[model samples]
Target: MTKLTLYNNLKTVRAQQKLSQSKLAEKVGVSRQTISNIETGEFVPTARLALLLCLALNKKFEELFYF
Candidate 1:
C-alpha cells in the first residue's frame, strides 16, 4: 500500500483570520506548542482534535487537511 502524506494550509488560514497560534490552540484546547507541532508536520492531530480545529477555524476537514 502507498503511504499518504498529510498536508495542511493551517498557517496561511490562521494568518488570514488573524489568529495567533496560542489563541487557536486555546480555542482547540491544546498547548501552543501542540499547534506549532501540527503546523510544522511534527505531529498529526487526533480525529477529535482535527474536528475541534475545523470547528474553531470554521473550516471543513478537507479545507484544513489533505493527502
Candidate 2:
C-alpha cells in the first residue's frame, strides 16, 4: 500500500491573510492545536470543516487542501 502524502500550505495561506492560528481556529470552530496539526499534516479535517476553512480563509478548497 502506498502512503498518501497530503501537502497543504495552510500556514503560508494564513500568513498571507494575516491570520494567526488561534484566530483561524476560532473562525473554523477548532482548537489552535487542531489548526497546528492540520498545518503540519498531522490531521485531516472533515468535509464540513474543510468548507468552513475555505470560507473563513476566502480561499478555494483546492487552494487549501491538496495532495
CA-lDDT, candidates in order: 0.94, 0.91
Candidate 2 lDDT for residue 46: 85
Per-residue error (Å), model 2, residue 49: 0.9
Q: Per-residue lDDT for 12-65 in model 2, tens only? A: 999999999999999989999999999999998888988899999999999988
lDDT of 1 by residue, 1-67 (tens): 9988888889988999999999999999999999999999999989999999999999999999999
Quote the positional error of residue 54 for candidate 1 in Å.
0.4
**What residue runs in model 1 are displaced by over 4 Å at the alpha carbon?**
none
> Candidate 2: which pairs clash?
none
| Per-prediction CA RMSD (Å) | 0.6, 1.2
After best superposition, candidate 1 residue 46: deviation in angstroms? 0.6
In Å, residue 13's CA in model 2 sits off its true spot by 0.5
List runs of model 2 lying over 4 Å from the truth: 1-3
The estimated TM-scores of all candidates read: 0.96, 0.90
Q: Which pairs of residues collide in candidate 1?
A: none
